[model samples]
Target: MLSKNLLSEIKEKSDLLNSLKPLSPENQAKLDKKFRLEFNFNSNHLEGNTLTYGETELLLIFDQTEGTHDYREYQEMQAHDVALRMIQEEAAETERPLLENFIRDLNAKILVKPFWKDAITADGQDTRKQIIPGEYKKTPNSVRLSNGEIFSYSAPGDVQKEMAELVAWFNENNGTEDPVLLAALLHYRFVRIHPFDDGNGRTARLLMNYVFAKNNLPLVIIKSAAKKDYLAALNRADTGDLSTFVEYIGNQLLWSLDLSIKAAKGEDIDEDDDLDKELELLKQELNQVPNEFEQEKTYSDVANVMENSIIPLFLELNSKIDKIKDLFVKAECNIQISHVKPNGYHDQLFFTSDDFLFGSSFKAYEIQAAIINFNCTALKKTIRHKDINYTLQIDFDGYNYRISNKFKNEELIILPYKTFLSKHNIDSIVKVVVSYVIDEIKSATNLNI
Candidate 1:
């Protein structure tokens, strides 16, 4: 339903960008970095991430984070970057069909993990609901409009059916339809469905770009500054005028094309505002007190936490695993220490003894993280699976400490330096580890217990 004029404009821009073909490696890399930062910063900012553009660049590119925002904000930004890379890789597989599970995985990657969120019930009562990543909503969701009216999405019971139809329509018209229009429609339909409890907006944007990437078109960004216009276009689409939203997306695509074409011609693509923003950030950094910037724990602090908190947690985990060891033919637990040496090198050294900390050599280096691996060999004729291995990892980034499994980069819990680790922390860590072990045992041994 796009007007001929708009469609022609989009075609012209697309052709112009295509004519440039491959850009220089250096130029392409610069463009990629620019878009990565811009996309991550703007998309999350639209959804209320408090990290500034400069802070986003530092965190994503340099692994250096600043500001005093909740650690969850930082974690979500990183997770969104992961989801971006995932779509890029996924788009490259031209032969593979896009499926519901892939979309679910994308949602999971963006949200990072299941957690509870505050919500308002239909009767206007405030409540909290658990958001399970990669799954359709079990509870209904709605939004409040600028006019103070409630705007409801598709009902929870109807979501599965609607989503199946949406995916089918997308796959059916994917190639034949104009990629820009296809991207816009995909975004609109997904938003209408609101399949997940949280992260629906972010997920919708990613899926829209996935369509563009598959078509080898420039990735369109919905600038956070222009969020009002973007929402207005969606509101217009809600009234049955879908073409306006398509035109809005087409215009955004044109912006991307213009930027890409400039990069192709070796022109400066950075806006004047970028420098101004950088200067503002510099001023803020200079005005802050010294203690405000000292958010990260020192090597000595790391040593203290490992000794006082981590060792006890590890011992507790070992004791719990020991109780379940008899269920398998061969079950063993081991510990490995990860730390930075005096030479500024990172190393992971194996430790065999339960009292491994008693050695003087352990205190010689700066400890950063620890790993515990539990390995089990299933009893023949007793268990079907041959071997089961699970790993728990605890590490401190410069700004925060995290506990997670070695196989997955997802953090189970992120703790700040101020809280460090308490008895409550130890209990939470042990609970997760023990639960995972039990689940793995049940799956491997087929025992209900």
Candidate 2:
């Protein structure tokens, strides 16, 4: 039915029965919203609907339309979304079997009102075909590809038996086949029949997901982006390469399942990651995007904080440190910020003070140690206040923080600036790193204001 490894991976990751068993009804409904919007937008978009995702969201969520689309486009987007939701409701009705009537209802929901559409007839003459919503085609239908070949569906005379056969095959295999295969084959078979006059593709997709939903699996989308591969995969099935389409559907199932998992975990799902280029997707998968873009943005944010805020901070503290340059007491000291290392180098949040003398009883290094120890104490107190789990390692080379009690395979570096900016409203980086160090120094060195 499908690749054993791929199926195994999906089963392992999905664990749908166990994973979904514990979720509350509200959580389930919340999860459905994400699928409904993306599925509706991408599905309609593939069929040449001109609504942007934002516009679709606007119309669906707020009843406020945004785009200059034909009113049919708006109605279809709303209708398509409703069909998806209705299928979910139908799937919930235990007694409702997959049937021609159910499929037509979905198609009718897609068009809302029937109208005539223009098409090229078999003899290559332009003609207007009467479209009765949810009804079978009275005349035959076929697509003329770019190369001028016609890919035809069942003849008008044959659609009835073919559709009956399609429904029976789906119902017979409904609980018997691997669900991903069942869904993909159901779609391929139905599309081959071109059973409805206008909403064949949309109905195929809605039926595809209904198969998954009935099996307690999460729904998957054919991103409009995967259009090329989506069509190619279907064409492959036409020539009897069903595995390619099965894998395509399998991949989409995996993709949606992963997205659902991360979404459930409350992680940010990137919109650009949803589909592939050329945008024809049977909801196949996109590879993992490099974190390079996000990491670069983060680096930029950190750099902005340093340049605009952190540098001036150090210069101000250095000004105060500049004043102490004149006084010569018993011991001279320098304040240096470097990595908490045995003998290493660093990024130069780097500050060092000119020699400043205290009294006879003070050793320079001892005073520095006292300052470091006090800073450590204040850091620990602050960490406790924030409820972070880490320890400060203070030494002559300077201080570093690490997760002392937590363990992970890869090191999790805590860039002080990243932590600073990520918390937002980090007005002063110098206030954080410098204040703790300098305040402790002044107190421990017994320096008066």
Candidate 3:
């Protein structure tokens, strides 16, 4: 049972946090980087991502790690950063409501390039299975309890229907509910849905915070050290006991709120208590651990992997996106990837075509990600929904970029990538992205109406 006084204190702290919304851009960047590192480290650590917090810090902040680990670990961590940024950018970029594709994109970002994983079956049998990113589970997914029984989620056939219901429920009740409550509910519900095979927990947390971001609420990052308690809270929520889990999430959120408040006040947030000491100790621990599982991969080896794997994927995506430029040319939309060095960053890094709205130009790596912006009357089309005329808008609305032509954005139907390829085939990904944009354009047309 949570103390009423404690709950009241949380509410008070949250109110104080609400009063401090819109942290200045400079302070926002500082706190954003800090929270991004801490949250990414803790979230991944909870999922058994082998990198230590110090290592995560080194990689994210300095773009290098002090020690070596699995290449997948590095790749996935970077992918997570990208996904986190995607959620943040999508949230900050516009006021569109959440979309299913954004969630799938985030899932894909969790595991940048998917592969197979050996696993345990529901009957306690061992087997091998492929893990597909950016899609719902195709096989049965459940948790094994200590008693050897299974805690099953939505069956493969029911995932889509249930997820649709979940989204509809959220869309209906989200803004009306308390932000913390809504976040906790979203987290618990997603866990129950267990939509994806792996990275469900991480993805759930991301979606939870994505809700918080939508509400202008401080995002919570559960501490890895609190894993035992965290799982216990989740279990409680699983068993129809929700208050405890809500309280747990509330406490975590309160901590984040306090941090934001501190940053808003211009207080030095770099060091508090033994954080510095703890990080140093963590670094020392990482250093002492033998690299027994180390691979013989070098920078050249990584570069080769990127060249053979990631670059081709990017190229394919670029090709698919570029093909759509001419279609938009008739609409007079500016589509360009904003290219810039790491330091002179703008809204987005990718700038491939001219007239990509929300993308500007600068130069750094010639082949790096460029912003895919659509501006200058890209969203000028009007549509009729429920007898009300609306103009289509394709900017990121806190949750997902959708066609905001009417009061509610119409569905942007995108076909799934037809085939799965392990070599990071960009065709499917680029297809989904471009298809979404195309659907946005199609949905805004008055033809059907």
Candidate 4:
């Protein structure tokens, strides 16, 4: 419920905007552009879309994207724009009722398509989950907050029932309540439910604006720059302080109202941060020019690889496996580099040479000599404990770097060569390496974990 003074304030602004009949063509275009950019850029940015305001404007208005963003990010921005226009059209049809399918369609539209995302389970295990856009989640979902606490949303089982109830509540009180208040409450309620797996926040904002559009009010923009405040308000609402969030939302509506009045009065409606956004885009464009010549890979590059990637990798494995060394009768760790034999039966087999060893620094000449003497097929680390053996290997063939062990293998191809063997990458390899050794021990010893 809104305070009487706030309601009166909103009514006054609404009345003034209404008195300005139809805005001129120029004013209308300016207002549309402003609203479109504000809504699209902020809404998606709140959900971690990396496009800057200038990039978003370029993509949405000029249909020319100027960034190295993921293709999906660009697609979602365009899809969200389409959904924005769609809701405006829907809002114009007064006879049309808000339906669950319509809301689901908005979710589907903004998300673009189904895809898989990396997720962490409640037990803190890494896993992949498929996002089915426009549909309710099939499994449970939760988020880890800034404070490192897990916040779970409404369970998947209750989504359909709660959503139906939400829509009914909104439609029942649609025209009677103050439009801004209604929009605010509608946004909060929809977010509380979190109906869709992904895009719930984006969808909630869209739905909130739907109420404003239907009531002929200026749609509020939740600026991404103020995400902390926005989320803080939502957090307060979670603790039964709904009015705090309502007030926060009301203030955002005031901004939209103020901008609308300016646009209606044919005044300059450009934001204060517009110049900053332009300069940022200018800098990004200036930095995107390519160097004239490409650097060739040399022996020093291999030596750097040995120092930065291979040596650290072996030490990391040694540190982890050293913890369980007591369980084995005897544990030995060795570095093995593959030497491929042309037109031989064991061509693919990796054989160890005295030249390649872990923890030993190799000079540029030494790396050159090793590569020249041995037809290097792969680099491998093998841990032998009693009769059990475990291996972690990197198989690179000029095109892809594939890290494989007994448990799992991952291809680190998209990342740059220098950064392909990152800490996270090494951790993943180490995890599987440790898990493989543990599993082998368990199998041989028949020990219950």
Alpha-carbon error at 332 in model 1, in Å? 64
Pick out the ten consecutive residues of candidate 1 with the lowest summed lDDT: 440-449
Per-model TM-score, in order, reads: 0.63, 0.59, 0.60, 0.64
Please write out the lDDT profile of model 2 over residues 1-449, one tens digit for every residue: 68889989999877854564555555555666668778998899777675656456667876875424468989999999889888888888766788788898899899999788766666544467788899998897877554546667789999889899888888788777888998999999998888777888899999999988888788889988687889999989989999999999999998888777766665554456434211211101111122233332233443343333333333444554344333212112222233223243332222233222121111111211111111122222222222111212222111212111122121111233233222111212222333334444333332211
Full ranking by lDDT: 1, 4, 3, 2
Cα deviation at 57, candidate 1, in Å, is 0.3
Judged by lDDT against the true structure, how good is candidate 3? 0.62
Which 10 residues in a row give candidate 2 its minimum summed lDDT? 365-374
Using lDDT, give the best candidate's number. 1
lDDT of 3 at 66: 46
Return whichever of 3 and 4 wins on lDDT: 4
The 10-residue segment of model 4 with minimum total lDDT is 369-378
Clashing pairs in 4: none
TM-score for predicted model 4 compared with the true structure = 0.64
Global lDDT of each candidate: 0.78, 0.60, 0.62, 0.70
Q: In order, how many clashes per candidate?
A: 0, 11, 29, 0
Write candidate 3's Cα lDDT for 1-449 as tens digits: 34576678777877886687777899898898878888888788777675655567768877875433567888888888888878777777545777788888889889887798655555545466789898898887655564546567788899999888888888788668877787889889988888887889889999988887887777789987688899999988878899899889888877887888899877877755336435443533454454555444333333333334333444455455455544343322222222344576654332233322343222223222212233323443342221111222223222112222223333221111121123212332343344445545543441110
Judging by lDDT, tell me the better candidate of 2 and 3: 3
